[model samples]
Target: MTVRVGLTGGIASGKSSVSSILAELGAVVIDADALAREVVAKGTPGLDAVVAEFGDDVLGPDGELDRPAMGALVFADPGARRRLEAIIHPLVHRRSAELEAEAAPDAVVVHDIPLLAEVGRAGSFDAVVVVDAPVEVQVDRMERERGWSRAEAEARIAAQASRADRLALATYVVDNTGTLDDLRRRVTEVHAELAARA
Candidate 1:
């Protein structure tokens, strides 16, 4: 039995850190963001599909997808965002399935999905682990680490599912407001539970 865990959290809330720890603990981690980029890389059909839907101007001089340029268009327009998802989501799913298939039986497989709640997909996993921090903690990290302006950080946070919503589906919640050692301890505890389940 493979224990499929979906790990998600607000932007800058430390999902990546937890995912890294889980990987180090022998979980087969499938990263959605990495696969999203891979699907849209210079030579893939995902990039070509984007060019077909949005036109060549979304590409940079070197012919790669100019992400920020395209982000500007999609983030500001709901229809455009959906169209882009229509192109990329299936490809991401297919690749993710392939990676999940490669994991051993009884291995704990974690899907690091930033938008699991926003996409209403928390129930698909055998368990969901939410890396939680207070909104202020999230905003502070976004500003201090990612250098996002206060408004930008707030906007990004607001765009996701509410904390209550995420927690409602969580099998494990790693509160990340404290020190690194504290967070690591919580992660290890959760990892042990997931491994036991497997």
Candidate 2:
């Protein structure tokens, strides 16, 4: 049997680190963020749909999707954000399914979905691993890593599902408030449990 794990966390919560560790442990990792990008990349039907919906201005000079420009628009407007999700989500789902189908029968397939809770997909997986950190740690990490101002970081955090909501959905919670070594240990423990189920 396959063990499907949905891994999620807030911005800067180190979910990617846990996902990387899971990959190293032989889990078949399917990254939603990567599929999101691939779907809307330069010469695709996804890009065509986006341009048709939002216009050509969403494209950068090099004919690629202007992510910053798109982010600003979607972040500020709920309707625009939903419209964008409507375009991207289905495509990502289709691609993700294709990847998942390619995994071995007994694989522990980890789907690293940043908005798993926000998108109401927590129950779809056999297990959900939530990588968590305090709000302050998240804010600081976003500031240092993404170069976002305090206000910008907070705004992005506010845009996602609340920390409480995400934790409520977790079968395993990796508290990522410490060093990389600590995160690795926690993730490895979780991976072992998931792999056993597989």
Candidate 3:
């Protein structure tokens, strides 16, 4: 049987790092963020829908989605963000299902979904792994890694489900407040447990 795992965390919470380690440990990783981009690529219907909803300003000169432009609009307005999600989520879900179907029967399928909690998809998976970090750590990491100002980072963080919410959905919680080595060890333990289940 395939063990379907939902892996999620807030921005700058080291979810990506945990996903990478899970992939290295032999899970078939399906990344939702990557699918989100693919669904809205320049020539796709997803992009067309976005353009229709948000106007042409959300597109760059080259005709692709201007992410920063879109981000600024949606993050400031909850309704706008919901409108965008309405267009993108279905496409990503269909694509994710297709990818999961293609995995081997006994594979440990890890779906790396940054918005799993916000999207309310925890119950769809056999297990949920949440990479958790404090809000202060997330703010600091965003500033150091993504060059975002304090307010910018906070805005992004505020847009997602809270740390407590994500934790409540987790079957396996990987605490990410420490060193890289610590994260790896914690993820390894989680991966081993999932692998045993598979």
Candidate 4:
């Protein structure tokens, strides 16, 4: 009877911020990004597969995955990106499922998945909550808050599934174009709705 809610948003759209608020309201937040990192940590099976496919150069001097170096290799190469996803996606999903199973039956479990739209996982959740903001707002946040150059911000935003597509899958949409207080209010409202549903 747990409510498996998928929470997603575009880059810098305050998705993680909303997820934090949801967690504060007693939802069990299982982060896909965090799980992805864990499954590929220095000695995991995931890292072994990555090393076999991308070579040892992708590893840092301390033997951890050199994330920047790996990003450089895969970001520009579609085949390389697919290979990496092939290795990591299943591992991430399996770990997420295990975590979800540990939640209380009546818990409102929120899975923070950045690529929910692109990965076609919306239907797997009881409800999809989209933390949305105008693309221009996201671009500004990237530049001012994250110190990204305009070009870099635009490129990163373009890399994700489109905002339209993300919203299309949203059972609840929290627009995050304003202040932190405004965003939190929206998240609290959504959390209440989710809790009731659970």
Residues 1-198 of candidate 1: C-alpha lDDT, one tens digit per residue? 999999999889999999999998899999999999999999999999999999999999999999999999988888999999899989999999999999999999999999899888888999999999999999999899989999999988887899898888899999998898999899999999999998
Q: lDDT for each of the candidates?
A: 0.93, 0.96, 0.94, 0.93
Q: Pick the candidate with the highest lDDT.
A: 2
Error of 4 at 39 (Å): 0.3
* TM of each candidate vs. truth: 0.98, 0.98, 0.96, 0.98
> Between which residue pairs do clashes occur in model 1?
none
The local distance difference test score of model 1 is 0.93
lDDT of 3 by residue, 1-198 (tens): 999999999999999999998899899999999999999999999999999999999999999999989988997888999999999999999999999999999899999999999888899999999999999999999999989899999988987889999999999999999899999999999988888888
lDDT of 4: 0.93
Q: Please identify model 4 stretches exceeding 4 Å from their true place.
A: none
Worst 10 residues of 1 by lDDT: 115-124
Candidate 2 lDDT over 45-135, as tens digits, reads 9999999999999999999999999999999999999999999999999999999999999999999999999899898999999999999
Cα RMSD to the true fold for all candidates:
0.8, 0.7, 1.1, 0.8
